[model samples]
Target: MKKLYNIALCYQGITEDKSKVSNYITYIEDFKAQIKYIINLGYRLVFPKEFYNWYKNNNFLKQDICMIRFEGGLKSIMPAIVWLIENKLFFGISIIASREKSGVPEEGYLSWDELNGILGSGFCEIISHSYNLKNFDLAKQGNNIISVPVLELPAYFDNGLNLYLKGDSVPYFDRTIVESAKAFPIIGTDINTNNLIKSSIQFITPKSFDGVLLRLWACLAYPVSTGYNAQIRVSINQEEVYSGDFNAISYPGNIQWPEMEFVTINFNKEFYFEQGKKYNIEFETLNIGNSSFRVYAINNGDNNIILKTSFLNGDNLDGLVPCIIIGDGSGSSWTLEQYSNYVNRDCEQFRGATNKYLKYKKDITQYAYPYGAYLANKDGNSISSVLTDVLSKNGFLGGFTVYPSRIYDNRESEYIIPSIAVYGNRSNDIILNNISAYIGQLFEEIDLKNIIWQGILGYDEEDFVESNKLNIIGVTKIENYKKKYKSQLLFKDIDLEEVRNQDLSVIVNGYDGININCNTNADLNYIVDLSNMFKRYRKKLELTINIKIFDTQMTNFSFINFFNILNNCFLFNFKVINNNKNNFSNSVDSLIKIVNNICTTKEKQKIMISYNTDSIFNQSNNISELSLNEAIIKAIQLGVKIQSDNIDYFYTANNISCFMNTSNGLNKLSNKIKQNGLGGISLY
Candidate 1:
């Protein structure tokens, strides 16, 4: 039996001329034909409740399921709903709650009572589209034209580097004034022609300020009594800003430390330095007479604070850059604060919608981003973690974006599930054919091997796949497993010579998993470079990544973002470890929920739940032995596999014929596993 495909089809109005938006709006006759055509294709129309329930339960259906979603909660959609009710079909409506209060007939918006009536029919499942879709759309586009009252001051970051409030001023001096004993040659007139120094420091302007000034500590190595005619020039982006005779410069001495003398070179003319723009400050000094000056380079730890510092002639003192200070401009900070406040208020409106939906006894668990906009600001930055956090808090399990793809195995996040747009501009044949093509494409892409068709919906694993032999056997040490299992082995430490001699099929981590520290930028860059490498490689090699969560309380969003970066790079196999507490079910349940929330449905099937037999049997006397077996079986049925270190535990504890040593036990265990459609496991 072919595995059934899940398709979520969304439509707008049923009327031909309901609104100006013709993208999703289909005529009444056209929608009727589309439904009939879908029904003819052996598709079962499910309400949102049923669809989400099936998805949450990990219940893959044997027959294709179609979820009909209507947007805007328009009155014109009601006529189609009547036809759906008469035909005994199920559908969902995404309501713009703000429009419901107005209940404008000309606008085609439905009243709350009307929506409740449709809900009572048991044919319609309602979800919040948004509080005010219009305003949300405008705000997402970086417009400040919102009807709702907004916060006065919003939190803004300092040039997208530091988070700051409205009152917080941008730091004048970027790095700490740590003076180094060593000095670089800035002006050496006493020496040869090569002694002329050219030094430059490039910095990204942290914020818009009144004036720009470059200050660095400089001391005369050899002071000339007379005829000190050295020319000193300061240029901003190659344009000269300051020029003077070296002897004419006034050096201010520190009160406590007289040797810590510094020269402040103020620009002769005020140059407008835009916020976030990189500017180069060049200091060129030529020797005309006998005068020698050396600039004291400061050793600052923060390399990111100031971008780059270079000395052409001397040692490349990377982080030891000059100090740049800007004049105070708190007013400009307030302008940035206003924009931040506007964006926050827009996010707050999402929460407002969640609150309003509770009045109708409907908790919105899903969101369809208006206009399919996922960006938080006008500049297309990374997908808004702030916005996703808000939606996650508001009970949104996931949101859909019209990215024109099937719900892929490697998705961005639960917040950015891709959906294909079905425009009413096309004919019913074309729309239905397009959906069919998507299903076919998905089947070809996510090709499940040895599938058992008849038992697709049942927890009986036999209905999913037909395989008695283990596909992958993983071990910490290959020498032990290779001599025993004698087949495909995934190893942490691979012996290339042993592999060649034994003719063993070995799976090694694409990027040595042990070396990865996801928290560090260097490790992340390594993964990125590897991804690009794999993308460019001509031949396909099986790429596998191993991720162990040592810190259970670690922030998941960072991991989510990391996985998003490696979305198409590799397939992840999860090995769930049950600690010595003997509470295996809790660990299994928690990991399952985490995987479900983080991974797409297709990826979920690829996940393998590994159990350390030592942890479970260490205190097996007090453990719920039967419950452990049940938990393992449940995980297997949910498309998760169990890889135990000891194969004897299943035979001894559960009294099952799973002992690999005996042919009867191995055959029975393998049959049970094949029948249940469990993802292949590894026994170390």
Candidate 2:
């Protein structure tokens, strides 16, 4: 026993003249022919509903069962139902009817009673196409033209309705007649040529079924109009399928009669059509006025063939090529990963099947997997849900968030906070911002200041210098400057012997004075050692540093070198002292001047500076109270403020005083500087 699959043959019937053949004769002929073809092919025909139920239960014999669907009007389907029941061919069938004319009183041919009688027989099922096949396109183009009642009005100038002095009732046949008829409800009246013209026109053709195979298919028809000398031409596959002209002939008395004439063209020949192949249908019209046209192609056939062909040919699903999937973790739930995998898998399956059944040879290309794990959480809770929800609200996808689990320690649970992760793609920033806004809504109670953020500071490729050269230049120049000024400085020639010989016990008793007296050579040496230690301490307190290469041009190589220098400087806890001197007001002045100069230079735009508290506390207001080393650091921070061209180059200072106090104790407290109110970076 071969497994049988159910197949449904769907067909639609349309009339160029619905009034002339208002019964089901035309549809019955086509349906009977379709049924006979299926039976001849050794398949049993069954109704659609029964076939569905049978397939759901037993999966139907793959090659033995088929179903037929006749889609059109009730008038066209009623006769087929009678024929099926009378013949005792209790096979399954479904009827789809146009809802618009179904309830109309059938004229002499088939009344509404007869139509219902056939449907009540239960031989066929009825499906609605639509309440009315609305043609908004025609209504929009018609622009308030009235329809007339041409069929009911008399033909001559009799007592019924008259037009003019010529004793002709032609005025009754004008637009007014059609408009007046349209005003009345069309319940039981007979549809005439004029009525059909007023309503929307639907064109049908044999090639309509080719939509299953062709990438492009269209229908063309000239709508009803009062225009003179109008024609419509249509062609399929470069061959003319339809062409016709319309004209309103005027009788002798300077009077006009409104009439509608129509012609239809259909492609009857079979042509090998394939998916993704370019197909063209051209429409041309001339000598028409104030008229509109519409074309529609109804497709009902086996589309699996086209889908399969496209799959085998590697014509990506709907023309979207698969791309790489980035980020970590399982790709199961990621839509991007899933979509890409589906395409790749389909291609692979197609290749395997082709090799076995069609002997076709093809190589499967591998796609690259994405990098990084989608951080599930940066803190304790899953941030994925929050991030995803935020992205959805903002109408964007593909934004990333740093997972709490990836970066934070469980011990720091209280401080664990998710920071919005931004990708390298600039196009996704707005979406990420929206996501940030959404996350803000959920954690409204938490202080944003407690959260820590990580961001990359991109360097300008051109401004970067080689690390070795930059270090050599900066060190050599500073050394040279120091050598040139060493003798002229005030502190260089101070006599140590005389000061060390004097007693210093009295000064030691006070908290404000220097603790060691320098009266002897040993005491002087001690003082110098203490100053050196303080210098080292100040170096450690410098949080931000900048280097300027005057002669160097910014380039990729230069930036690489600059970054290397920055990393080394940060590691060694040393600040690069700027040697620029012309702009100095005090020790702090020299640093500030250099900072301002660097900020103004376009080549050094990527340089960044962060504040260290020791340096910030040594500004001019507190300089008198600071030791020599403390003043140096305070000058550095002030210099940064003076020279910074934009706030983007500044990094916020982190308070590490608590850690310092715990590690070093009271001796460290003596040197602590108080922070004065200074406005930092603006958050907004």
Candidate 3:
């Protein structure tokens, strides 16, 4: 049985009542009592740093320890120091102060001078209670001013005063400046009563700790009173090993109730613990009041068990394995002398070995064994193609090779095994080719049972039939035919011709059309011109006008010249089939010239022209066949007749041409005719 050492008694809720003077005195008395109790338990009071170092280096006997704390500011100063010094008690004393309004202060709830005196006494260690007892900064607006000394307060006051005197109101004090001051080397705010008591007990009474002679199996602490019910759960390496509970109680008429108590639950089960891993024990309160808890542990049992387990479990294996090579060079073009030298060099570089060339030859002659050879390359070609060929020819099992690049690029590296060549870049075609050649050479030397070739292609081209034709397997970027030919199409000459025609039609119909109308001007002088027309001999019926004009002369005339001629013509009947202004009369002659010049095998013209339907007699005629010059002249003649009697007309032609062929030929032609018709011709 291990001798138990009671270390500390963790406490909570000491300074609560600010209005009751006696409550403050009672809290101070309870603080002193806790110190006396630990000393009686035969445990020396130790600072956190001291205890931590000792626990780490020495074996702690199984004993109870105590860590005492109070909540809120000091209702009364702590007397633990005077009591311990006078009585010479053999227990550890730690005072955790809760900075909360209802928690304790670490420096015995004393003034700065008083705290320093306690520190000078060397009987106690002071943890922190946040400067503000009520934690005002973290709370809603309150009357309590936080007492934590702000390191930058002086500087802030200076700046704020300057600004205030300059007619500027100062904003709230800077939080950053306060936080920086607190973080300064000597300005760390002590843990408030809440954290101090919680952390102290949790430190000494760890649910589990490890050392040479002792090991803590399990521990649980809880208040022993009603009203406040708190439970702490502890575990080692994620295993729920221990738990305990504490309850709060009320003391009738006794301000120093001593109602707070704890219970430690321990597990006797044996477990092998390892070092340098995280272990945790958590405390959760079922009911709110105030409480403190701690956990402790010792070292015992065989430490070597963990190390042995690690070794037997095979947790240290990684990296590549070495391979042996065997082969002969009789069937290969390269002589045994050259091949052996190459094998030896590669083997040494890769930290490998191969059978002796001379001894191998002897073995082959004596026992009818086959030749053994090895080849190495960084490119995948040697192993993928060349080795397969060589082994098949020689009728012997070939040695393995590796492709470094394939492995690096996460390609099919396994294919390089049990073959002619080794590592190489799979992405480079040259590397692949070299691997193929190397395997081919190997096959010539040895008669392999069956040869397998591995080839890689692009992802999109993975299904490429060509890659399969070369005895290669697996998809890669360059080998997938679908990807290789994604943007390409195959078509016959007839299909292309059809497409060309369709394109031409779209341009003719989808675009606007130009209309030109020719009319005769009979007015002599602006006044009484009707008298001159009345004197004319009988109006000529069926006027037979012989108009001889060159294609260029009619179509190439400027807009002014063309319209002028139409104004001068007598009873001209011409109609345009399209209305696009870009193709107006000015370029009609140039268009005709271009059409006549297009002398393809199919005898097709490519000129785009439009005419007005109102200028022609028949608006529903397909005039695509009309020459450019004829189209313009006919339109002019129709325009003149329509103007004289207000009667609509149309034009007709065949084999008309347009620029480029498209898929909308019929619609384009219809639009051209409609645009140039007398009054937008009906489909009929």
Candidate 4:
């Protein structure tokens, strides 16, 4: 067994309050307990090569630990991560998965050198947190009129048709801060969160029509724990016609951008109207608690309704940059060159600040740990999404984590991890064919090898979904899609290279590993069928299966058949989640029981304890989960594997102070690994 162990996490969350420099150094020294400390190379560039030399000279890093997270884009953090690899202070880098041409801000990603350098590090492993396109903040969202060009002004609406308005009288909910969204000043009436607000407008119809389409652009005033459904009433010419409710997303903090939606009020058929008819429009919504919504009127007179709600689009505010942190007073209008200059200057300012802080720092000297690229995404970025192909071409990507509904089998990767994401996964449940089709869409052109096809069933969200907070509140209905992989193999895309290259040396793969909460006869049949298929393609594809049948519900399968089936597959990974984990402990009797029943000589090497979705601080639960470092030591003793030894799933900065600079805060994460030995750990 490997001797060394430690908890892994980025130090971004660590914060120290008002304290003397000496106390701060002592706090930093407490981190010496972590077997491996993954440092964040945020705006400040810590050239690992130079830092590594200094540490080595000072007898630092006598033990193996400390991976670096190049948090932003490669151009910003590459020099540091690469320098670490060159100096032999090699460790894995976390990667953000980039989906599209990248979010507009190119400064937030890594380059080929930084990626290649992490790959070159012999002691490193790259775990992509998740793929993201960073789809927010690109387009301007506001009143429809403001989105239209100035040349297209004076637009009008008659009956249901939009026409040019010669003159019109309408009122606006808010208009002064119209173009800006960052400053959300939605106008409305409120008296201690209990007030009803009404709005009205008058228009002259240019032509007659049977019925008219009315669109309302508005936003909610309050953030809540749950969604709020506002009761709204609409009237035409002071006559009530429609009343209904629409669900509004919670803002959580009673704060939001200025964006509003175009809600339509469509009649079943046209309500007859004559040409040049005068009409009045009135609208009101019930305000419950601190929930109120803001509505913005477009400059145009048209109020046409649509079949569905549409987002209002506006031009990018004239001279604003996302990262430059432009204050309200700063005027807008940035050329590409100007934005780039701001980014460069911002980086230098941060770097300079970091140098001044680190000078003569005692805790900075206690333990200097260098990390590879850290991949989870925030600030509108997924750094690893675009790096997938790069890693695969270099033969470094080890596995893929994808939805069970969507198969992402990377032929070059050593493993493929699947998870369930259907809180209400989708309104529709996918069939086996749909699963196969989704798989083909992703792995169409990749070459295949003796790849062991391993898949994970549903588990707790972010450790399975995104962010520990459950995006979906219920179990996915993929139960039908569950325990059904073998029948879908016929649909596996044929890897032409694998066909031509395999005739000389045939490799074998283990049978399928079907993970579930509780084992079922149906799942057993699925596993056995996969076993037989592998037997036929034994020479062509050495497929190994990893069954995780004990996350939520334990299997009651007869040990005789389960033993044979478990042996048939190469590995079995299991997980369970607690919404509230304040009471979790490392030494759970149930975990021991599961290991006793599942761990066999043949499966010992294949067994992997998931190193994802764990709370660094203690939690409350009957079967409290183990902290990363505790689990690593326990896994070694029990003879199993742990994935993502570093912190892999965290969202929000709420718990940052807990890990920042308190003497008892982050040091609790270092654990015994620092005092005992050093080793390697991996996580999904």
lDDT of 4 by residue, 360-413 (tens): 221111111111222222332332333333334333333322213211111111
Query: Which candidate, 2 or 3, would have the higher lDDT against the true structure?
Result: 2
What is candidate 3's lDDT per residue for 538-601, written digit by digit as tens?
2211111112232324354444443333333222222222333334333434433433453232
**What would the TM-score be for candidate 2 when compared with the true structure?**
0.21
- Could you give me the TM-score of model 3 versus the true structure? 0.18
Best model per lDDT: 1
> How many backbone overlaps does candidate 1 show?
5
Query: Which of 1 and 3 is ahead in TM-score?
Result: 1
- Select the stronger candidate by lDDT from 1 and 4: 1
Off by over 4 Å in 3: 5-37, 54-58, 61-65, 69-75, 89-109, 130-684
lDDT of all the models against the reference? Answer: 0.46, 0.26, 0.25, 0.30
TM-scores of all models?
0.37, 0.21, 0.18, 0.32
RMSD of 1: 26.0
TM-score preference between candidates 1 and 2, better one: 1
lDDT of 4 at 495: 29
